[model samples]
Target: MQFKPVVALVGRPNVGKSTLFNRLTRSRNALVADYSGLTRDRHYGEGRVGTYPFLVIDTGGFEPVVKSGILKEMARQTEQAIAESDVVIFLVDARAGVNAHDHEIATMLRRAGPKIILAVNKAEGMNKVQATAEFHELGLGEPVPISSAHGDGVADLIENALASLVNPVVESSEETSMTEMDEEALEQALATEEGEEVSQELFTDHRIKLAIVGRPNVGKSTLINTLIGEQRVIAFDMPGTTRDAIEIEFEQGDKKYTIIDTAGLRKRGKVFESIEKFSVIKTLQAIEACNVVVLVLDAQSEISEQDAHIAGFILESGRALVVAINKWDGLDQDKRDWIIREFERKMRFLSFAKIHYISALKGQGVKALLKSVNEAHAAAFRKLATPKLTRELRAAVEQQPPPRKGIFRPKMRYAHQGGQNPPLVIIHGNALDAINDSYKRYLESRFRKVFKLEGTPMRIEFKSSTNPYKDSEK
Candidate 1:
């Protein structure tokens, strides 16, 4: 799986960690409450700052004097979060000032040695800002004052925290060396790997892998039919009709693509049949294998839990996601707008995905959908030249300087394009772990806007000066 950077919010009870998490993630996935210890389990959500996306983890709050089993479990979960996180947000309540519990948490965070950002929550008005000075006594550096409820300073706090974790010198090139093989040779190799009789003629020179995924009966099959202009895959109103993934080859604008139609996925307990069990696993495997995923959603149905589950899988797998709202023929403009807005709001984690409204049965937006697919495919393989990347890096740094964690100012030495096919770029820098998410997002957004990687998911590999070995060398 692709490794997205992970940030964990750690603090004592009732310090608005969950509130901040919801704000950063732009989702209500985490349960927020006034009561302490309500969040007993760890919650994971996708967080985005500009175009740079990362996983945001919300752990149960810490309580120093508690000895109950539940509190002990919460502590264990917090410790695990610290260990797994790439950066830690040491949140404190500015309204409450620096208390004994805040001091204790700061000590533990220092011991953990992860990149730390002290966030002072509930600092809203001028008086609260003055009170925020008290948090300086915690000794975790100048606190970023924020109000989780009113959405003030949270963005700046997150931007500052994440900016410290990015490495600007990473190379931006496809690590996979292009093997100059003829169509016959490439097909033969792939067939041999699969241990099956596959057609060499089916493989094309510039083939793109696109997987159709969604809840059952979202017209995935219908959309595929519209794309290929053939009823290659069966389309029916019956749910779970597609029991296995079927790959079809087609050419679009001189480029070839393998379109995969997968079985409709349901919740685990709802999926009982053996065929369905196998189909779910196969669909997940296809998602991992494909370069881009077209998530089909029913325009008529409200965005269901199953849709979110499928989207989550695609995002977590680190594949480029495109949303196709099928069966948009009868809907009015207002309805379409409402659906689009609500869908975007609910699946905010999939904000990276481009949305298309289509009437698969009527062929209304099929052409535009295909064009988007082509653009997304091309974007997926985009690579940046070293000079251009370095220029952009310099510009980004000059615009907004990296956050200083101590006396040392982290310097990004160099960057190079390492690979494509989901473009990978690596940077060499000082204290690479301290490069925060905001700066990383700024750099990524700048890179995407300049390079015009409109619909692809690109990864930035942050490497310190000590680790210079490329995968090719290994």
Candidate 2:
């Protein structure tokens, strides 16, 4: 697999690093405010300039002198980002001038040994030479004056940054050229009935991006370390130990997986610190980026509303889910029964997901958890034949036709596969706009049963047709 070059944006507090991040990636994923230290985690985003695509890392304030508390952790994350990046964009505030902290960061970057691009931000209306004059003392290189917020000289900055890549951006053709036989097979697939064999060549193996997420200190890091057979991430006993979203690539048997260990999420009301609030945002972004989610829950404690909230967000995101109740070992039968009942009562909506009890500390049920992850991934991307889908839809309507709303009963129609990753079934017919929620759920259940779409969310969209002649007659 070809990997994009990573560009790390390093700077002190309130130096417009996040602003430059949003400007480069063309996304506001990194929360930007006037306050300092708003970004405490390494937030990742993808940016493409025409055919050139690369990954960008937005880091927290780089106070290299701060040796204690969250500042030190943020400094560590910036260093890691710097190490992984092919080029580093050291941002300095043009208004603030070259400060002691900037000099300190520059000294460290000199020894770090990545292609460094010194960018002078907030230089919108100032003279380019006068704006970049004092930054020469940092000794990194000639400073590139640009305003992150005003979009001045930003594209040139990115082009220069990507030019330093060891492996230049070679655009891969996305168009899949199919042979005549493959085309015929695809045509037959649309007409094939349920349980019939389709072309094996239609499917191909690729890496699965899985994310392990949950509340703070719920053994998420422990589970990741146990899965990779190493203490890769910090698995400390303290809460909020893992602050950044760390991606690790490893293979189990023949399957390749890139597992992301993300920061813990706290309820909004309980999140008092601004850093934790930003951590929550990064966690949510991680959930959005992955193909499957492994929600790690604490088996020792009662199921909290926060856990359900996280699972609900997963469902709303339409990603495949696998629930892992961690620390299942050493629990009494009574406690286990109580936990099961609590889960059933609270997480009844997540019945489509596969659940497992595992002890990450003891390596018990780990294999089964991975098996469920694989199964969920496959189900999420599974293809459904249109003829089979339509047949199943007809059978569902026959068993229990939709009830009449006033004088118009919703006419039944054929269904076809519209998308994957949360298989979308589009039903085309008249009066579909009047279908009730209960009937929609019923159809969903029927489709889920016939298609065996377990461990993944399924969606049904109704597209109503209009009668052209009725308008003229009226």
Candidate 1, 179-256: lDDT as tens digits: 234446543443443422321122235678888877667787777777777424332332332223456677665677
- Residue 2 error, candidate 2, Å: 15
- lDDT per residue, candidate 2, 377-435, as tens digits? 88887777666776788788889999998998998656666677788887877799899
> What is the Cα-based TM-score of model 1?
0.52
lDDT for model 2: 0.76
- Clash pairs of candidate 2? none
Q: Model 1 segments beyond 4 Å from truth? A: 1-204, 230-244, 264-278, 467-474
Error of 2 at 183 (Å): 23
RMSD of each: 16.6, 9.6
Question: How does candidate 1 score on lDDT?
Answer: 0.68
